[model samples]
Target: MKIVVSGQMLKYQVRNSSTSRSSPSSYGTASPSSSSSNGSQHDVTLLTTSRSNSLVSLNSLDSSGPEGDWGVLKVYTSDIRQCTDYKTIRVSTKTTARNVIEMVLTKFKLTCRDPNLFELWMELTTKAEGKPVKTILRLENDAKPLELQRCHPAGMSRFLLHMNATGTLVRVYDHNICAASNYKSLMLSSLTNCEEAIDLILAQNRKSREESANYGLFLTTPEAEAQIPPEVSIVSVYVLSQPQHKIVIRPLDSL
Candidate 1:
């Protein structure tokens, strides 16, 4: 059996165990598509990469007609410390900043309780006092991404997908021992502390606060792992978060 799952940034190919191993298939230089065939088990899991930037025509890149060809937009997250690379997306002259933000969230498979909690910003870098200074310009919801990119030079400016300071979207793992990808997204206010975040997750699951005391929110990353203190706000932890960061619920006794 063969199955194909497609997303904005990835295309996954799944095959049954009977098939012979094959060389990976590739697409283009700037944007490459790859395929993997595994034949050891009944099921195969396809992995996603951060390098799937599709190609577009150079002339069509700046077209702004009502029926213009597809254009490309480079998007990156506000979490610069961890997410150092930009993601490429296909956009048209009609695509707005809000629409690009939604596309990015979907590409990353993140669900936010409030989509409005996110915004797009234009980051401009200039030299002042013999030093490089960075300025961020917030884009309106209706602002066009393709047109905006056309206005600025490639190296001097960039588009950033940022979470509003008002609140942060958090992913919470369920209270299970297994390492499962199924999780819930919660909109946490900037002032919400670790303890409050736990309560919110429990409430969403219809669990009681009494059980919350027995649980703790732990953050794990490639470099290090630690349990978040009850008094620390979610925004604080979020600032130091990485792309692969995870906040999981573990029994207090296990910690």
Candidate 2:
């Protein structure tokens, strides 16, 4: 009925108090101590988002409970304080990235000074080269189920959950972040063709193509035009990816 998520107090109110035991969450749907009046429950379907920068852990929830979206997720933390759960988790495919983090807080039975200021980053990479491609999961869709918004790579069931910096609105990162709130950058190899480039960009910017009617990947610089023959090869084409209304430029200095 009523779901409330904030920077602190992780609580989820999907089960009816009558049918379920009283569980505690700092990122709560209802007040942690409050329950249904006539013994009713809320139906909440979790959704997906991208991991931010830092990481969380696994031992944050009840792993022995009834099976839901039972899968493995890695929480990469930089420090002891960042280590919220075990390095890995047994999660459900039905759950979202936001729900996973909240579940972590609930699993740890801890509270944060600012919890809503975090995000989930789905790191897309290859098994061969370990190429880094990141995507920002929408934080607002905590209530939506992942069935419709699945970002997990095929055959690669596991996902990553990263945290933002504390006491700051800015997210600090040392590497190239391919995904975020809006537009993100991704690298295309010289051998990648136009079709392959489109596929690569779309894979990282799922939210982008969904929102814009005029989305495309092309060369924006005259320098590129001069070097790339009119032959139209992926090696010469740089991507100007737009998610929603934001423009993401790749080949940084090229354009």
Scored by lDDT, model 2 comes in at: 0.36
lDDT of each residue in 63-93, candidate 2, tens digit only: 3445545656664332224434344655564
The regions of model 1 sitting more than 4 angstroms off are: 1-64, 78-84, 127-132, 168-255
lDDT of 2 at 156: 38
Residue lDDT tens for model 1, 42-78: 2222322221122123223555466665779888753
Candidate 2 weakest ten by summed lDDT: 167-176
For lDDT, the strongest prediction is: 1
Clashing pairs for model 1 are none
Q: lDDT (0-100) at residue 102 of candidate 1?
A: 79
Q: Give candidate 2 misplaced runs (Cα > 4 Å).
A: 1-69, 79-86, 127-140, 143-158, 166-255
TM-scores for all predictions: 0.40, 0.29
Instruction: Report the alpha-carbon TM-score of model 1 versus the true structure.
Output: 0.40
